[model samples]
Target: MIIIHSLRFLIGLALLLVLTLPLQAQEARVTTARVEERVIVETIALNGSVTAPRTAQLSSDVEGRITELPMSLGDRVQAGDRLLSIDAEDVALQVRSADADVGEARAALENARRRLREGNRLGEGRNIASSELSQRETDVAIAEAALERRRAARDRLEVRLERHHLRAPFGGRLTHHDVAIGEWATPGTPLLTLIDLEHLTLEFAVPLDLHHRLDQAELEVRLPAGIDDWLPARPIADVPLEDGASRQFLLRAMLDDPPTMLPGMAVQGRLLLRNGSGPAVPRDALIRRPDGSISVWLAREEDGEWRATERRVTPGASHAGRVAIQQGIEADDRVVLRGNERLEEGQRLILDDE
Candidate 1:
């Protein structure tokens, strides 16, 4: 009976090893990546609308009812393009009155000279008194002063009437329309918003920790895709003041181009840094757990089989698709570049493309 019991126990142990062998030898399905060292950082993508390089709200310098609108909104206007015209009836009447006054003054001055000429001909012995001649001269001077005052007033009104004929400040397209043909556009009323689309700009931000990186390289900004090709870009002058919450700096870059650009366009660009060679991996290579922690899988060679080990990583500056690993991984450690989710510790993998 003892020999039979020992034989059954031995058979049961052999069967257990058969089942465990297949389980231990199972291949791990995973994606592999070459190890590279690169300067990396996580970044915050900022979204903003495009804005005109210069926005001018057209308004009337003199109060008047608009008799005509020569250009409508969205119309391209050149410098000195007439936009609006005010009623010139009152101003024209004033100018005529001023001209009449000048004529009357001229007549009075001529009459005064005639009196003086007659008196001079009579000489000191004549009945004409010197005081009387002086009185006539004074009357002529007074008439001249009155006429000059009227002329000055007329000229001042003429300027206001000229202002009623609005013109474009620069050659550009009109973006807004706040007035109509017969609208009573009073002084300080906005007539339209003009934009010069030739010059474009992009406003973005850089983190405080990574702010020093931008200063290290001659970075060039570019408009993403739709705007235009061959658009030139420039860096910002000063970093924005720190936000107490995020501790970041905002930057505004203007794109100088040949003709001009429109406002509110999508833009994507890279900010070159002084960083040397470093690992640039797909931003998704790192696993972000529900605990709000970031990590990367380090593939270790154990017993001639690839093993994936999770390591916590601190990420730094990021732009486009790649992220920078700040800590937890080394220059030559194999990382599961793609399909790392199915990996388990001590699992075996056959590098598909290897």
Candidate 2:
């Protein structure tokens, strides 16, 4: 009878222990606040080069030895400013020859008129045929045509001679120099490279896959590292064709205020995705698989265990490393952070400080 009583007491104690162990397990794990909110996701993070709106390679129009170089690289100039002067000795000689020809032609034309008039006045008796008078008139016409031709040639030479002194076509700064004070400049030689940097450009490339996002965009440019504020711009131009290698379309924009922006400086911007609502998550939450697959582990209550389950997520833009969750888990979902290594489908996880 004593043995039977002992067996009964042991069985009761085992039942009590088994009933309390689950509560202990529940106390061991941690819980996080489940908060949900609407998020507007945007796609805009892209890289591009800082550039100018207009660039020109000024060329020499006249062939001559450069006698003066008044402009240097980075020198600001205005329209019609004497950029450089070439020795015009040869051009001047041509001009003089042309002028002399014009004078001789004019004299010949005058003399022919006088001869025709004298013939008509003195030979009125008989020797001067009507045909001879008509011939004289034709000779005068020929002289007049030759004079006009000489005058035209003179004007052309004068225009060429004016080009010997290179002048600025527009207001710009000299960004290069190819001629010295005594260097020979061939016609069409690049003499200077000019750029207008005041109103500058930020030509950026957008991947063709993302072209839809930017195709109708009003751009917003920002350089978080260089500038404190976002710079908005109106769209300017684009390359209709996508780059075969990079599959990106190039674009340009004019800044609202660009007198302060410097050209060729490092800059980055995001094309505004007029659609202003999308979800986002910390970039660190993304788990890149060995095969280059991407996934995330979500902590959830399942089968009475606070465990992590892998979920494949489609990620989008990343701004300052904060990734936009275009398609994946909803907001306020607890994801494994530090304990991702121990994470598995239905594997128990406890946030250290949850």
Candidate 3:
């Protein structure tokens, strides 16, 4: 009878212990997205600036005092238009002197030629000595050389006179004008800044890794403040030289139909490379770890329960809030989009249906 009582007491204690034990903890709620296969064209973004295709700083080619400056800042000018004029009085005087010298030389040449011709005729008649005829020929040759020298000097003087007036090298708008009437102008002194807006280019420095791909890619430019849409551009130049410090190569593109764009405006450039099909996931699913590596939380079934699995991935270009997974993750995989920050390796998860 004692044994039976003891057995009943033990059974009661077992029941109490079973009731006191804690039940399995509820699964944490999470939002998940299925990885999808998509066609993604990789793109590279580069910062650039708008620049004129042609720009020049007009400088004085002759030393003189400024006499005429018809164009001012913001003035539109055509090629060969007079931008600034310096006093050409001294150069003009030199030109006149040179002209006088050339005329004198020509007269001397003509006289020498006439004498030589007469001497030749006299020699033919045996009335002039051979030595005298030779001397006359020598005089004619000397006169011809002197005439050439004088004419060359006169041409140089005329060119100098023209240089006293600075002309526009191309059609452009003047942005700077530093010369004034009566201002002393010296050779190589900058007087005006001209920029051609009709042919504008977008310039950028891209990493050397993209040097080969630049030609094959389609480029677009986005002006931050002026234009609302991306402007299509074609690669104009890609300099092979690279910056030593940045390891970047210079690239320039011509805009197809730029609108109201100006030089020096900041712009963003996009280079779209070849189209590729790949698995893509929501951008929010990506997590950047402290070590600067990117990863995503994957919900995997284990022991008949959904558990979070950390996956290391290589991320490519992003579009429409979705990022292309270059590696590590595949299509049809459940990727946790929300409530993943607190996820742990193999931790149980409850999917949110809403």
Q: Pick the candidate with the highest lDDT.
A: 3
Local distance difference test values of all predictions, in order: 0.70, 0.75, 0.88
Output the lDDT of residue 11, model 1: 99
Tens-digit per-residue lDDT, 1-354, candidate 2: 999999999999999999988755543243333323334445567677678767788878877788988778889888889988888888789999999999999999999999899779967777788888888999999999999999999999999889888888778788888667888888777888888766577788777787666665657777544576777876787775544887888877777775365567766777656445466666667889888877777788777657767888887766545666667778788765554644557656666655
Quote the lDDT for 104 in model 3.
100
Q: How much is 33 displaced in model 1, in angstroms?
A: 2.1
As a whole number from 0 to 100, the lDDT of residue 350 in candidate 1 is: 66
User: What TM-scores do the predictions have?
Assistant: 0.58, 0.60, 0.64
Top-TM-score candidate index: 3
Rank list by lDDT = 3, 2, 1
lDDT by residue (tens digit), candidate 1, 83-149: 7887778887877877787787778777777877777776567678778878777876876777687
Model 2 spans > 4 angstroms off? 1-41, 61-63, 111-129, 187-189, 223-227, 240-243, 275-354
Q: Report the Cα lDDT for candidate 3.
A: 0.88
Cα error of candidate 2 at position 61, Å: 4.2
The alpha-carbon RMSD values of the candidates against the true structure, listed in the order shown, are: 10.0, 10.7, 11.7
Cα error, residue 305 of model 1, in Å, equals 5.9
State the lDDT of candidate 3 residue by residue for 162-215, as single tens digits: 998899999989998877899999888788899998898889988888887765
